[model samples]
Target: MEKRYASIVFRHLTADRLAIRYPGLRSVPFVLATPMHGRMVITAANALAAAEGVIQGMVVADAKVCLPKLVVMNEPPGLAQRLLRALGLWCIRYTPVVAVDPPDGLLLDISGCAHLWGGERSYLKEIVTRLRGKGYDTRMAIAGTIGTAWAVARFGKASPIIANGTEVEALRPLPPAALRLDPDTADRLIRLGLRSVGSFMDMPPAVLRRRFGGGLPARLRQALGQEAEYIAPLRPAPPYDERLPCLDPIRTAAGIELAIGRLLDTLCARLAGEGKGLRKAVLRCHRVDGKTVQVTINTSRPSASVPHLLRLFQLQLPRIEPALGIELFVLEAPTVEDTAPVQEALWAGNPGLEDTALAELLDRLKSRSGTRAIRRYLPAEHHWPERSIKEATTIAERPATAWTTDKPRPARLLATPEPVEVTAPIPDYPPMLFRYKGEVHLIAKADGPERIEREWWMESGEHRDYYCVEDQHGKRYWLFRSGHYREGEPQHWFLHGFFA
Candidate 1:
């Protein structure tokens, strides 16, 4: 099969992105500026600014004189390159062989994949439509080679899609800059009456090399398809992806169910063979109408159970639209983990290291009421009571450090302790009575003055002397006296938690 490539260029990528974020800048004259040579200079300008005679490399003060009401803002660091990289990653959904074209462009090896979107025309339209929807000003071109695609995207007519074996014709009328030549070289060509690519491309190799540098001829041959050029495309992230192509397009709900089942089975088998499991997955259906429908599922633990995953998918299957008919099913587990094999015991079966029932219950609860409905906490090795525990991702993970046995902890912990007025002898005695929240409570029994020092590494604060005391009603309370007691100062008391 013949190779086909597509290139996308964002003409004013940074300025356009800024306009999208700040919509008012789209119509108003605005330039992204940075300090250069002790003067604020224009790094990039929006379409509105450019139309008002403002351009890059112009000093901001001079630019303001050109458009008196111009708005100048600092350009985000590496703005163009970052946007290009992000867009390159997004293009992976179309083709896996996508490469970054530096500051403002991307090269895609569409190859045989274009037919899936109904042809190169529809494929190009889809890409452009999505980018325009994202509020970017894009110019795109598709052709037989990357060089041809790159040249046409920047220099050819708007939205050009040239056919295979026509690169020479497509590149002939373009300026010398279209061959990726520097300004000095292109100016030299223009001075010699060699304005277009065709005018100087046919020149003798030695003459061209002597007149310009060796780079100009090499780039010209690359664009003309005379020399083979290889692109080190960005390899798509590895996915535990399983795909199923139907022999005939199926439109019925039952057929869709069966396709999902087959994909789940295949995916589960593969995951099991690899000794891995999925935590998050997406089911993508490629409908015959050139549209895609997707359903996502998340598990509380790394799971390979086909039935459990199918149940989760069934809950979201009604949301899929089978417009004409579905031709392909793709199940991708974007998140996976190493799952140890279960060793069955002689008397009973084992569900790996943790209880599977609890995991299943959590998954079901999360699927119904959302992930926040269920949560488990693990003990952290922090001396501060409030920072001693953290949310646990899975039940199988054990705490690295044991809970502190030196001090008796409360059953219920409060985010911040409430202030309590206590009547006690200063310095070394427990509180005899305390007024908490509007009620006075008499201490029937009490145990301890456990001294806990403040964690100076995190923050500087007062040390605490904690005491577990029972009220007249037998309800136990955890109280703390803050700071060291001075001879003439009264220490502040606080209610930190409750003991069971």
Candidate 2:
């Protein structure tokens, strides 16, 4: 099959992305600018801003002079490249061969996949329509060659998929820039009356090479499909995936279990050989009637234990309907982590709560209560009590620094501290009595005024003086006062949390 390529040009990718987040800007004139020297220079502009005479590289001041109501935003660095990369990754759903053309375009090798989406026209239409629905202004073109597709998408009078062997004719009317030439060379060509590609395309290769260097000829050949242009396609992840196609459709629980066992056997063997394990795996069952049913399992640790993983997926088996019988089964481990080899006991040993067993238990808990229900926390070295503990992404991650345990901490910590009214005998002394949650409590005992300074790097004017106090009812509470007291100024207090 001839290699067919598609190019998607995002007319104003940066501005459109910003407009989606702030929908009011979609219909209004706005420009994303960068501070060049002392002046704001337009980096990108919306359709409305472009219509109002604001173009990229123009000074914001000049643009404002022309359109006084133009809204200007300081463009965030890498916003364009990041959004472009995300869009390129999103295109992988259509074709595995997707490459990002930096700043504002994506190249997709739709060679053998056009038939799946009807044809080249239908495929291009579906892609463009979906992107427009997501608030992106997109123009696309499909052709037998990558260069032709790129040129047609960008500079063609009207975007059309060029037929095979007609690239030279189709590219003749476009300017020399469509051939991807250097600005100076293109300007020289224009000055010499060789403005359109056809003016100099048929000239002697040696003559063009002598005037414009080798780049111009190479590009022209690439666009004409005379030279192979190799585009490095982005590799899709989930390198650890296994599929099982049943000769006979399976509907019974036993058959599904058997199929799952086979998949797990293959997947685990592969992971074990690679010395890596899965943190998350999803099982997709394609039904005979063209429906899909899926179940997912997650392990707290990277584990390649087959029985343990099979059990985790088993707990989720009931969730899969398989309404019309499953015809194909695909198990994909999208999330994986490298795990160290398990050390075996030299002699007789307990082997109690080992890696495999612990992983199985965590997986079971996750299956029953859902993934978010289970959480792991580790100590972080910090003087601030709240910052002393942090959530651990995985149980295997160890603390790099020692944890601060010099001071006593509350048994229960509030998500956010609540305000409380307090009465104190002295400005520096702990509170004598406090009113909290519409109830008054007499402070029978007090422990601390552990002052924690604010991290000025993050934010200023944020400090707290914490105190652990026991009330007359024997309920202990962690309290804090914001800032120091002034002789005539009012004081601020808050009930942070409770102690056991």
TM-scores of the candidates are 0.62, 0.55
| 30 Cα displacement, candidate 2 (Å) | 1.0
lDDT of 1 by residue, 1-500 (tens): 88888999987889889888888777788889998889999988878788888988999999888689999999878888878877886776677678999868999988988987889999999999989888888889998877889999999974489887778788889988898888899998899898899897778988989878799989877876778888877755357887677878888888988888888898899998999999999888877655678888898778999988887877777788888898777788999998867653641344464666567667777777788887777888777788788887666777777767778899998789999999886575889989998999999999889888878988899989998999999989999999887877777999999999
Q: What is the TM-score (0 to 1) of candidate 2?
A: 0.55
Cα RMSD to the true fold for all candidates: 8.1, 12.0
| Candidate lDDT (C-alpha), each | 0.84, 0.86
Task: Tell how far residue 139 is off in model 2, in angstroms.
Answer: 0.5
Off by over 4 Å in 2: 236-500
Q: Roughly what TM-score does model 1 have, to 2 decimal places? A: 0.62
- Point to the candidate with the largest lDDT: 2
What number of clashing residue pairs does each candidate have, in the order they appear?
Answer: 0, 0
Clashes of 2: 0
